[model samples]
Target: MYCETDDELVELVERARKYTEDGKVADYIPALGRAEKCDLSIALYYTDGRCFKAGDVDKLFTLQSVSKVLALALAIMDNGEEEVFRKVGMEPTGDPFNSIAKLESQVPAKPLNPMINAGALVVSNMIEGRSTHDKLGRFLTLIHDLTNNTSIDVDHEVSDSEFETAHLNRALCYYMKQHGLITGDVEDLIDLYTRQCAIKVSCLDLARIGMVLANKGRDPETNRMIIPEGIATLVKTFMVTCGMYNASGEFAIRVGIPAKSGVSGGIIGLVPPSMGIGVYGPALNEKGNSIAGVKLLEMLSQRYELSIF
Candidate 1:
């Protein structure tokens, strides 16, 4: 067995802790700037009914871009794939998650994929609701359902920080609106997207959510479907293609699991129908994923034979 006990997993996490020192904590968002830079943790929940946890598993952190997956899923449910596709493309941009060049030069100015900020903002706009608050409530509800944790809440300070520093995303939203790719109020959509990104969770919460995806969007423990099959497939495809910012391709080859990485130093990866692994290491590499997290997942995937490939 790869990590027979929590202690073994803790040892592996400690061994990889050095990688976190190689990266920097996200400072762009002032609230996220408040997180401990050296925080490191891992949590795993297997569909076969095994669980392992190590390190700062109880520390709460903002979801950051990871919330894009849930927002994309809900958007697809509200509007079919084609309609959502109009606002966001399926192709990976291979650029920075917040790259403005892709938005300015791309056809239709549709965001390359929902995993990126532009695409996520576009998708967030399409969430069917009367107002930004309503849409955010629904998005949080979906996350809660998937994790079966009702206490999940947005950190308003983080949301406020992101909202204040969201110039690029705001510009992207305006560009999208001008191109007619996104309808309704641009600021409203941006606010909703920012709020979604600020939602907080721990490694344990993330592992549980990953477990849902691992089981094809079903709550493996509850035996309930949390997401439609079609939407789950779409989300998983996007995760494989664009989850790890610009390093998604490299990660897919090396780590080989459907995964999503957030700038907050959270990475959620899962082997289909098998296991979900969540890692939190606040230091970020050049590609914006947690450095220690990437290394740990690469090793764990190999050791556990958890790669989809």
Candidate 2:
């Protein structure tokens, strides 16, 4: 009962694969290093329990920065948006995701918003828990609750790979500590943030999470609240405003969904009131967005008329 017929969805998948054939996979993380270039897939899940998938939909990939949306939403629910704002600003940085320029500027030293790496690290610290382990436990629970997927676990290999190369994020955490923007142990928070980013998921899981948000934090299938309504809207606003790094404006103009992308090359987007959609193309544009992913979303948005505006 999930789809009336998967034929149309199947056609879209074929188009996506053809459109993304030249895209490259992410290689920074050594574990993602050897992933096949042009590896593309998508999953679409509607509120009615119909699911459509195509291509390498089962392929496992790191959540990367896409985890920011969940962390930020949970932080706001745990401590209120006002408190979370004290640690991370809502304004767009207009700088690179890993840029330390804003961190060093007295004009606005705080990480701009949770979608960026620095801001996500700050948001991770704000999740209520006694220790990093406790915090991640809550995080894992949140993801599991949202996706209704119990088999999910941290990809230790990916986590370790990110940890080794996350020097920039670590430095940003240390600087934030010096600025009183982050009050916890810097090293601990950075490690916690890095670990959280390493949670592996597929297009199905990503689409399910997006579906919950599209349903205003309610699980469409179970009709249970996964995220509170208010916090869901808040997180969606942030995603719309700042989700795609410096390219968020362009994405909003084109794809017109409150979406988030991971450096691992996945994009989770939604068409509110209709469905949750996911696109995976590891080849990234210069802005760190998935080039093929963006193209596919633009076409989908145009065909479906899903833009909020």
Candidate 3:
């Protein structure tokens, strides 16, 4: 859907910036910790190629956990859904995104959903790559194809920084291996996950990819299927239920759209049959969501009746 007024959207972005000061930029990883906490941006792309952007639309950021969505899609495409689902379950854990508490207690020991670190590691390892670099190339190619932007690539420094501090991720991978949920080299899978998480993109890049999902997996310009409709639907449902860390259900209630959020403070919201929206505010709340971005989405959803419900 076309925005009612570009000025209105711009004004909303300005208002949302105030909340950014209350948030904390991620600091666990050295590279991500360097982001300016107040930086904020948003871009919205319609199916017809029209676009509306506000704030720092060109500011670059790593995809972080937002990469999980695409990695899961690629895995499902390489292997059928049944085979992939056998490796990961389709439910929310209600625990932290990286928590292994559930895995310790659950019987199957599969990740609750592909949005979490554990699940993403599993899918990244399944990307049909003979080597880690090849898997990265495949993931990059998928992002370029979906966004129609060939310039996007991984932020190698960020990936390297993440790899250095990925002790917890390494532990999760090993645990999965011991449970037979994952059957690969733990080091290789962690490398794949870390690199994918460090893939570089701006708000505009994310909006285009979201537009493809909004259009039911078909490229609006070429009418070519990027993914099967059923697959897109499955991924979107995961976004609604578990995309955000622990705040997913609250986000769904407030914004009422399918969405995924990254610790880098990027969020991709899919408004079916209309627009794909991308937001980046490098200031996260307690649940690892962009404090300002979520506020902006909530306001926009209310102002335009953008909620699917």
Candidate 4:
């Protein structure tokens, strides 16, 4: 069960979906645009193997930017903390996730943080891999191992669609390469990054992955350590500061938790020590967050006092 009052959570999701119309689905990425704007779902997983699900929880969606969190962790494991930080800064940029203006003005041109596209591209380059397939294979394996969902993998349809429309991302990578923030072939790095972004998962699958983060890298189901606890903490801290695109501060204040949201209207969040929450609402706010999903999280956080602060 999600908590003592599982039925209340169901009611919460139903209530939140009323606001779905306030935001629009992200259509620039044609694959994501195909999703029903009114679709909404939520799922929760706890370390003790308990689960709670609500409407449309089984709907599959691409991870989009949420994959940045896992990529950051894998990069740290492969490169260590100091080296990774030296390549990317830890500060948040108030600008949009894909904005190139910051790269032109910032000193040294290091990505402000790994949660954004520039930084994620840097982290993607940092991940251990000889080729695009190899890099994505390693990352995908780690995700499957942690979530124990061997069935999950890249959705090629979504990946192809994103690669086709990733002109803005291409510019970000090229800019970073010129500034020495990113190295190697820009095309190869962009390919791997886009592949990671299109990793497909349902809310339930995301909740399982989030559960491991909540448990500090331990898989609650098998009681196995996935990553070092230190890595997990660092990942969560970034989520708190920069995971919600430009709306992170508002999310941290209202929802009060460590979380990451994606352009596909999916959000993966954790309430430390045990609770993991996954939300999906194709309708997105101007800041690119799931409109109804955020509302549901707010209600749960307020009712359960799930914030770490």
Candidate 5:
């Protein structure tokens, strides 16, 4: 109900699209580097099953860091909150998401929060599975249920590309392993983490997932409980606190939505009790967020008074 027509959203998208020129795609990940820097799209899904979209909504992108939120939820469900938090702290870091400074400086040497690569690796390690394939299957099952799209799966190209460049992530895993924070083969853990990040989702798929979270883990259309209400709340809290890397506070002030962003230029946003938003803009700011996507969300938030704050 927030946005009455697709044209309204299209106008917003066109306005935000201008900022794409000010950013650049994430070239660090070779596969991700291939994304069109000027492309931007958005989809909004409501509890009533209404959806509004603009731009290339069918364009798929890897989840990248955004997968951390889903992995953390599953990890918490597999292992209790106490067990997961014992290995990873709930604090946000001012340093870059991939920075290793805090890991060395902290006394216990655990990653600050699950949104960062280090913490996400620990959470990925906690996924209950007999093997790497089994673990990824379980994670995919969750995604399938959330989006009602069984075809959703990892982009192996992106997975392999990320795995190839995951040297820093390997270091973080080894460091956490040394601190007794995570157990198991570092390489296997990296494989699972990288695959998890490589999961592909289109804007509509992302919006559907966000809609479930906004509805407190229930699929309004199917009337089924996809995730526990408490778990969804916890995940949303993390999205508010640490979802946008170091720019979370600024995003909160500007957009005021519980959301998660990825280096692949995807963002999943929640307008609690009603709507879920998905945005994709490959052009990234220095902080690894979708620059134009963030701007679009800010405009949508202000125009619709969508801030949960």
Candidate 6:
């Protein structure tokens, strides 16, 4: 195990918790703004089914942008990779996750990658369903399989808040629609995308989900393949390149793990072939990542030599 005991993990959490004072919760979403900025917690799950936890491991947070990775994986499974990539490119962007500047500049007008809001919206539209309920059900089903938690569902309050304030995202959709990138009703796409972002998961649940990915889409205990190995590899590659909004490069250099962070201060990290990590700290850096969460991962990476690089 990367962390032998809960006490060892707690030490790291306390050290990283100190940095939470320097960051702030994301307030633009309104509902997300109510999060306790000082809150920090972590969980690590190994392939052997051992889990080590620290701080308030019961705390729940929305997936926010981190949902993009899961949605992208499902989209690829529903539609072949060739069809999915035709709608979204694989390149990383220097712009902020929600920025629409690149959409206007790129000749094809497709999103640079599914990690960005633009690309994620396109992926959301691609989820095969006859209606919003069907689409979200399909996504929740994937979440259930990944985490082995059938009770996992969306936080409707957070979903509503995002839908109300998603003007910038709607703008991106319209732009993409103009370029023939995304189809169907714009509002419907936004509804599905916002709910996808609002799906709630505790640190433990996140760790379990990460474990599946780290195990290359298999349930460690059952060894059942929840996702194809190729899709798992593709998603992890995006997590390395574009996961932390625009700070992905720095994170790669520092932590050297495949990770995706959400504005809700949740991060899903992987130590390939063995361990999965989940961290929650509603205090965010300027780039929208969990500041303390990132610090804790950096410390763990250094201490345990956990870098996949």
TM-score per prediction, in order, is: 0.97, 0.94, 0.98, 0.97, 0.99, 0.99
Regions more than 4 Å wrong, model 5 = none
| Residue runs of model 4 more than 4 Å from their true location after superposition | none
Clashes of each: 0, 1, 0, 0, 0, 0
| lDDT tens digits by residue: candidate 5, 84-116 | 999889998899999888999988898899998
- Could you tell me which residue pairs clash in candidate 4? none
Q: Whole-model lDDT for model 3 versus the true structure?
A: 0.89
* lDDT per residue (tens digit) for residues 1-309 in model 3: 458556877888999999999999999999999998988888989998898899988799999999989988889999989999998889887899989887788777888888888888887777898898898899999898899989998899999999999999998889989988787788888888888999999999889999999899999999999988988888888899898878888888899999999999999998998699999998999889999999999988988888888
lDDT of 5 at 218: 92
What lDDT tens digits, residue by residue, belong to model 6 across residues 145-229?
9898999999999999999999999999998998898899999999999999999999988888889999999997988999999
Q: In order, what lDDT does every prediction score? A: 0.86, 0.82, 0.89, 0.89, 0.93, 0.94
Candidate 1 local lDDT, 1-309, one digit each (tens): 456799878777888888877899899888787778778999998887788999889899889888889888998899999888867788987789998898878766677888888888888888889988888889889988987789999999999888889998888888878888778877787788888988999998888888888788888777888998778878988899999989999998898999999999998877777677788998999989999999988878777777777
TM-score of 6: 0.99
Summarize candidate 2's per-residue lDDT along 83-164 as a digit string, tens digits: 9997788887688888888766645578777887778888888888889899999999999999999889899988888888
Model 4 compared with the native: what TM-score? Answer: 0.97
lDDT of 5 at 242: 96
User: Which tens-of-lDDT digit does each residue in 1-309 have in candidate 4?
Assistant: 236655877899899999998989999998888899899998898888888888897789999999999999999999999999998999988999988887788798888999988889999999987888888999999999977888888899988888888899899988888877788998888789888999889998888889999999998778788888999999999999999988999999999899999989999999888888889998999999999999999998987888778
